[model samples]
Target: MNPIAANKAELIAIADAVAREKSIDRMIVIEAMEEAIQRAARARYGAENDIRAKIDPRGGDLRLWRVLEVVEEPEDYFKQISLVDAKERESDVKLGDFIVDPLPPIEFGRIAAQAAKQVIVTKVRDAERERQYDEYKDRQGEIITGLVKRVEFGHIVVDLGRAEGVIRRDQQIPREVLRVGDRVRSLITLVRRENRGPQIFCSRAHPDFMKKLFAQEVPEIYDGVIEIKACARDPGSRAKIGVLSHDSSIDPVGACVGMRGSRVQAVVQELAGEKIDIIPWSPETATFVVNALQPAQVSKVVIDEEDTRIEVVVPDDQLSLAIGRRGQNVRLAGQLTGHQIDIMTEAAESEKRQKEFVERSELFEKELELDETLAQLLVAEGFTSLEEVAYVEADELASIEGLDEDVAAELQSRAVEALERRESGYRDARRALGVEDALSEIPGLTEEMLVRLGSKGIKTLDDLADLSTDELIGKGDKRREIPAGLLASFGISQDDGNAIIMAARQHWFADEVTDEATEA
Candidate 1:
């Protein structure tokens, strides 16, 4: 073969090799070469020329051109040509037509060759980075095994065959040492396209890492016979998984634990001996919470669904065990159950109940002019509020051991009078706070609610209307130091709060309609 043909074959061979090595399209590498050549030609000829370059993909035939526009009169001589002169190149040329003028091949100098090579390298690298990002972006939540490439600033850089992933310091299992060439498995938590390249962030400390490990060890999980519903981890210390089974015969916890603890042990080893608790998951929140706090006997569980909180009562001796070392057990249980758990001993729970009982009895005695014995009797029968006393069926009250119908009637009358007096006091306080009477006209605005709203500087209809339902009645964020809704203590539901705000804004709509009428 001649030297020119040899060089063309070599060019095609180089493009093939680059495409294979970079795992990019052969067309992309050829395009990069074209751009590099075009840049070099522009430097050789003139920077102001509209130069372009192209190479045949089948057999590397290089070509160069200077594009010029046909205009009535050429102002930019390098890029624009007169229509009369354009007719010499092409008889059919018209105004505004773009024509390409063929040019000779460029002989690259040493410096120009280096600059062209740099352009090609940069383009190929950018294409490779884009391919890496696209390949791994959807691979998040997957478990990948990789070799530890290096450690930088306590973060582990892993070689994942096609890409490099980073396990941040906080994402690694605590106290677990990793060295170069160590085989480690991690969950792909994030894949971000950054200026440098695609950032594949892996995590061994995430709860899903434990779940994925279980999925690997337990075939039942892999086949969808059992599913991991919830997981909580304390890094290298301990982890808990809540598993559920679709098939009735397959017990989720037992399947995850395996025969004689083989499956769970495999996962435990991978996690650096992080103890694993595979609990059977339940749809009932109480049942799930009870199972999550394992090894500790629980006497009772009181769940406040509105607050997403649980009060757990355990035996006095099991307090430390239920709470674990530094409250790790309860904390993991809370995370797994998705509830704020408060654990207490049986004695403490009893003391709380007694305290509430005394407070309610005293309220009845003071508000109803009742004797201590009668108030205690009312509390014992589950009548804890004045509203309950005033609104309860008269027959139910009369059935009490020491109360007749006449006594029940008198008790209800006194309860009503007491509630009215309390409401009057709240109204007086609300008025003193400069709250407008217009706020009282809105539905769901009670004297007590008005007083609370006044204290929060929501004394006018516009102020109340400006608030969202969540802001009016949401259980505020404790972490953010945001106070709870003004009517949250009153147990106002979300629907009620929305209705109240809409009612407050009714006047605004009325004013709009009135102005429209007056203009008409």
Candidate 2:
């Protein structure tokens, strides 16, 4: 068959069309076509030697060059031309130069055409994958909204604008129901490269959902006027957000709450109805901590500087509220406030006789040469009982700011002297109530045990001391992770727990009644 004339115009137009359709450079298509044509021509029958093909755009001609050597050895048989053969083609020719011979019509069989087509498809696919990877690799930690494509094996696949994302089972709220084609918003947790496509990891159960909600609903937060300083959450159950305002005129808490609680309510709805608490951020540890534990008023805040702990006390009615159903409130509050918060009820305080000492704290502060703030700090650091502080070394107190060695020494001496004198006072107070031997008569506790307990500030037999085996032994499943077996070793039982708690309450009432009678 005769060779088809080179259609240069058709070749250039096809290259441009392919480049535009495939989103590739026109020069790449031109190079691919040249490779296809050269491979086809070189593989034609009886032309197995090395043959190079070139297209002349000016004249629209396809030229073929056959390379051959002049050496007798012909190391490369296909490319060698003997001296005699070279002279036959050209009377005056060099021995070492390659010969150029014209090639016959070049065409490809079915197998060669299939191989060329496959090469083009593979090259275009690789280019597309690289382009997609470049577009999405930097969008980490941002929120993206997309349509739910389908669910596969408990994982939700979402169709993002330029790519797809997978919401793994663990990143979804437990028992939450979703449907196909529904729109969902999630945080982009990770972006990964795969052979087939870009793998994006998304989450709806992240604690940052609270912060993202505020950013969407609150104008102040959206505009950078208010910043979400920190957040702690239990995902679908509850969340606490700490917000600070750059502009004093705008209140971060009020902004998060919105008008009549619209903003927070909207966020709660989006989170499968999770409860949210918005607390104002504070630079001061004491004030920030108090605000962090909201809906539960703190009667006193003790800062334990040495241990980085803060003990918060609430009234009897607010104990359950402060701790939430299973200590969730205090746990999240502690995480948000960056402190270890210990919550206790008023009943516990009365049993420990902490109230009596709590009242006389001011007087002790004065006698001990400590400010009220410093005294509170000392109490917060596990030195709740006055006797503990009385025995503290002067150097130890001096280690704390504002308490010099001389002042700590003087305070220790005075507190010890007062403890000696107050021993008789306590005995007299107990005797006047007619139950002077009540504590010593308890089933398993000895005098030494009672004293050790008192030193830890467990002076009374109220609910705090009267804890039942289950109440004391129940391991916290969610937050505290307490062990049940540990509380059994103590001489604490259900019947005695109730009786001791009642006796402690009665003693407290008796003391209050006598004080009133004496005043009258």
Candidate 1 residue-wise lDDT, 1-520, digit = tens: 1112235677788889999999999999889888888888888999899999888889888889999999999999999999999999899989989999999875777677777888889999999999999999999999999999999999999999989999999999999999999999999999999999999999999988888888888998999999999999999998888999999988888888888999999999999999988889999998999999998888999998776779999999999999999999999999999888999999999999999999999999999999999999999999989999999999999999999999999999999999999999999999999999999888888998999899999989899999988788874422122355667667677678789989988989999999999999
Top candidate by TM-score:
1
All candidates: TM-score: 0.89, 0.58
User: Which 10 consecutive positions of candidate 1 have the poorest summed lDDT?
Assistant: 475-484
For candidate 2, write residues 1-520 as lDDT tens digits.
1112336666666666777776667666656666566666666644567777665543435666677878766676787978887888888887787788887655667776666556655666666566667777897777889999999999999988657898999999776788998999898888888998778899988877567777889888889999998899887888888889999888888888988999999999888888888888898888888888888887877787644578777898888888887889999989998778888776776565566556556656765656788766666554655577787766777677666888777767878876766665655544444333556566554444444344444454563345443444333222123444223334454555456445545767888999999999
Which ranges in model 2 have alpha carbons more than 4 Å from their true place? 1-106, 304-309, 349-520
Clashes of 2: 3
Alpha carbon lDDT of each predicted model: 0.90, 0.71
